[model samples]
Every structure is written in C-alpha cells, then in structure tokens.
Target: MGYRFHPRSRTIKMDDWIFSPVLQRTYASTEAHYLLLRHLFEGQPIAYCRVSATCNSLNVKARQYHEQMGYKYEGTFRKDNIARWGTPRDSACSSMLDDEWPLNKSVLLTYLLATNFDADGKQIRSLQELRTLQTRCSL
Candidate 1:
C-alpha cells in the first residue's frame, strides 16, 4: 500500500496496493488494510481517505475489495498515469470520509472476528454481505 497525506486538506491518498498470490484466499491483506485505515482515522487528524486502482482486468478484484470495505466510488481518472511499460492507464478512485469511518470500522471489526470464520478458515459471510447487513441495521 502507498499513502500520501495532504496536511491542508487533511486527506490521505492510498495507492499501489498489492497482495501476494501466496496470501490470496486468506484474510491477511484485508486485516492489514483495515488496520491502516483504523490507524489513520483513529490516530490521526484525517478527514478523508482516498484509494485508487488502475482500471484494468488485472485490478478488478482490487476495485471490488475497496468497495467491499465501504469506500464510495468517486469516478475514473482517464489516462492519469503511465504504466511501467509506458502505456497510459486509467484509475478508478474511491474514498471514505471521517464520518463514514465508524460504520466501516464496525463492519470490518465484525468481519475480522474469529467467530466469523470456521475451522477451515472460510468466512461464514463475506465482507460485502456483512456491510449490507450492517447498513440495513443502522437504518
């Protein structure tokens, strides 16, 4: 994960997210990302947190992951960056505001609980599903 902070705006931009193939299907990446968000929102004076994923098939999962974590989609930034191979890349942007963090944090904590997984380490409910349920409960 990459983080850039703007003091004046009290915003943090998170990019360059990666998860090793070996750790796929495990919740390690999810836990780490949530921890980072928790720290930023709870420990720092941040008002907003933005995350971006390169818009491509290879990043579909990454985009979904961010959405599952309750980041609201902003939009795509077309040709905003050049790839390592020099190709123009579009990026999908999303963000979570300070007021929105509490709900997301609750959902994350509930999903990360040991009881949420079984002996086989499979989640009883997905993060997205839990988020939906939590949202409904709040309403």
Candidate 2:
C-alpha cells in the first residue's frame, strides 16, 4: 500500500492496495485497511481519499471491494500504464470524500463490531448485507 499527499487539494491518493494470497478470503486485510483509513481520517487533514485498481483480472476484483469499503467509482484511465509484458493497462479510479467518511466509517465499524458469525465461524450477515442495512438506515 502507498499514498501521496496533495497539499493544495488536501487529498490523499491511496495507491497499490493489494494483499497476499494467504490473507485473501479472510477479514484480516479488510480490517487492516479500515484501520489505516481510520487513522488517516483522524490524524490528517485530508479532504479526499482516492484509490485505484487495475483492469486486470486479479485487480479487477477490487472494484467491488473498494465500493464495499465506501469508495465511489469515478472513472477508468484507459491505457494509463504499460504492463510488464508491454501491453497497455487501464486503471479504474475511485474516491471517498470527507463528507462521506462518517457513513462509511459507521458501516465499517458495524461490520467489525457485529456478531455475524456462529460457532463454526460462518458468517450470518456478510459485509454487503450489513452495508445495505447501514445505507438504508443512513437514508
């Protein structure tokens, strides 16, 4: 993971947010990501946080994940970068503004604090379900 501060815009450009295979399918990565986001929100003067994911098969999965994490898909930068194999790659961008942080933070906290799992550790209410409920209540 990486970020750059834009002093003029008061924004944090989140970059290269990816996890290892071992952490995949677990809440560890999500939890860690949220914690970091909370830290930034609390400790920084950031007005906007932006994240980008590539259009490749692996990174493409993050588009929905970013939405679940409270980011709104802005647009894709076509042929923004060249891949290791020399092919052009597209980058999908998303952002969360300061005004949206509270709701997103609440949704994240709800998922983190909820008793959504049973004895066997199977989830009763997924993040998506919790997010849906949170959205409805927020409205």
What lDDT does the true structure give each of the candidates? 0.77, 0.70
Model 2 / residue 45 / CA error / Å:
6.2
Off by over 4 Å in 2: 44-58
Model 1, which residues run further than 4 Å from truth?
A: 45-58
In the order shown, what is each candidate's alpha-carbon RMSD? 2.2, 2.5
Q: Mind giving the per-residue lDDT tens digits that candidate 2 earns over 69-109? A: 88888888887767669988777778877677788888777
Tell me the lDDT of model 1 at 28.
86
Q: What TM-score does prediction 2 earn?
A: 0.83
> lDDT: which candidate is best?
1
Backbone clashes in each candidate structure, one number apiece?
0, 0
